[model samples]
Target: MADPPDLAVVSQPADLTNAWLTAVLGAAVHGFSYERIGTGQVSDCYRIAVRYAPGSAGPASVILKVASADPTSRQTGAAMGLYDSEVRFYRELVPHLGSGPAPGCYHAAIDAGSGAFDLVLEDAAPAVAGDEIRGATVEQARRAVTELGRLHTLTAGRPSLIEAGWLERGSLLNAELLTQLYTLFLARYREYLSGPQRSVCDSLVTAFDHYLALMSAEQRGLVHGDYRLDNMLFGARESARSLTVVDWQGVMVGPALTDLAYFLGGALPADLRRAHYDELLLTYHAALGPEPARTPEQIREAVRRQSFMGVIMSIAASVVVERTDRGDELFLTILSRHCDHILDTGALPLLITGG
Candidate 1:
């Protein structure tokens, strides 16, 4: 293979020339075509069909990710260091994750000052992205949680990674901001919210500061801050990976169970999640192993305490991102399911009482 390309990051799909592809891919690329992929508001994704020189080695197709075209969203991504964190994840953290859950990063580059970034990644074709509105099947949910457990297990308590600058950065979503956002969420979405959903939001907003403090004090590790269905791609029958996680822009060092709770909160209907809750938890806990020695009850409580994360995500993300018809539906679906999870787990009372 040729030496790593010294090419600069391309800011948009129009800049993906054959010469640039050949250099970054370390192969002779005669031409390529790309079509947009995913519904991400903060960034754009494209599936590139590479036409390489005969016998030259390279993936036939790869996923190319770049900063969002929307100036507002691009600014938001840069301001929050989302682009930098994702670049660092592939450049710094994926090696440790092994072949666990994330996609293989072929190339990653970011210009922090400009927030211009690009990532070429393995195309997990045939593996369909999960649907937050439709929710996941029992089998899909099981696979997702199991992989999440492995992710947490790999990074949990690793002293070297625990304090890394990229992972340890503080979230901008503090209590005051969340409370303000929740108020805005209510103004826009209140009519759509169920009575229970409204109650859940009220409780969370009431205790936002206390909740943030409590969660911050808990055991922390690498967490996919937005670990919900939309960010996941479930595998096909013959696929190598059962799940391939994407969108590491929100990755951070935080309470690991928050990922679990965030995922479970929206990946299934309330009834389905309630019915299979223990089995799913056991699957994750078992995959996590016994190093930390958390009992079933402890895990349950931790998940319950962390359940409000999805609520926060739904409200905050819905308001901030470029809104669309699908964005509204997706966020509403997430909010409804997560409110149900909170009610089922009694997360509101737990937050109020500081458990």
Candidate 2:
């Protein structure tokens, strides 16, 4: 890969545990002390084991997502206002978050201006059975789309979240967004992607400015910036269609279809995904009944127009879900076919070098 920026601190299990207890629980010396149980690149998810609290007889536990405080995170690349937007998002929409199957936030905080953030969250309402089940499911897809619709409904025009002490600016989309996305794609992909696939990528990158401009003019609303499968959990009991949208750090105010397209088109098998594509649009439209300038027809149109995003993502991004040796191999396999499909379909602007 590449050397990381200086600002970012490498995630160490011990360091994260200390930070969590000291920053979140130590002051009160609460019965619940956390142990770093889950470690992923995104956040250090901890199992907060509570032996006993004042009145409680036994124990309680919850999941905690510790926001990264690495200096490199800022220097190398990351969206600005993302952490703030997430804290703001949970605070604003908690009321609508019915117990159905979502993990409720017990408490969420962002340090004054430093952007160091933490969340004391209720455990996943219903634990997902396995990693395979963890992948996108039709049920989860429906629930996720509906939730995004509901969120957009709540924070539509309000420019500031008065009660939450935010400008209601939604989330900021900045240079880092494009830079990181393109970098992540161009680096690993250049070696394996066919000339035609690279052509499509280059073509899209060239047209990015116009694309953003067009999307900017749409009736914007809250977006789960990275609404992919892995960031979510199936509902506590109902089904995969019923799910709790987990990661919120990348929340933003933008075209709503961005999330829907990302999931259905990005994750599900092509045929199974296309099957529900239109139906999902109608479902989401029904969710957002009457927002100003937000019409169902237009939203549906946006879905179709921007739907090609999946194609761009398919070729540029390695299909591997995470950091592993197998991940790279898997990504190459998926991308190579994607490259073939694009070229055979006449989708590229120029043949990328060394197809």
Give the poorly placed runs of model 1, Cα more than 4 Å off.
Answer: 1-5, 290-292
* Cα RMSDs, all models: 1.8, 8.0
Question: In candidate 1, residue 104 scores what lDDT?
Answer: 86
Best lDDT among the predictions, by candidate number: 1
Q: Candidate 2 residues 141-194, lDDT tens each?
A: 677677667655555545353234343443233334545566776666677766
The TM-score between candidate 1 and the true structure equals 0.95
- Candidate 2 segments whose C-alpha is farther than 4 A from its true place: 1-40, 57-59, 69-79, 92-102, 112-115, 129-135, 156-184, 194-196, 238-241, 289-297, 308-355
Scanning candidate 2 in windows of ten residues, the lowest lDDT window is: 1-10
Candidate 2 root-mean-square deviation in Å: 8.0
Top candidate on TM-score is 1
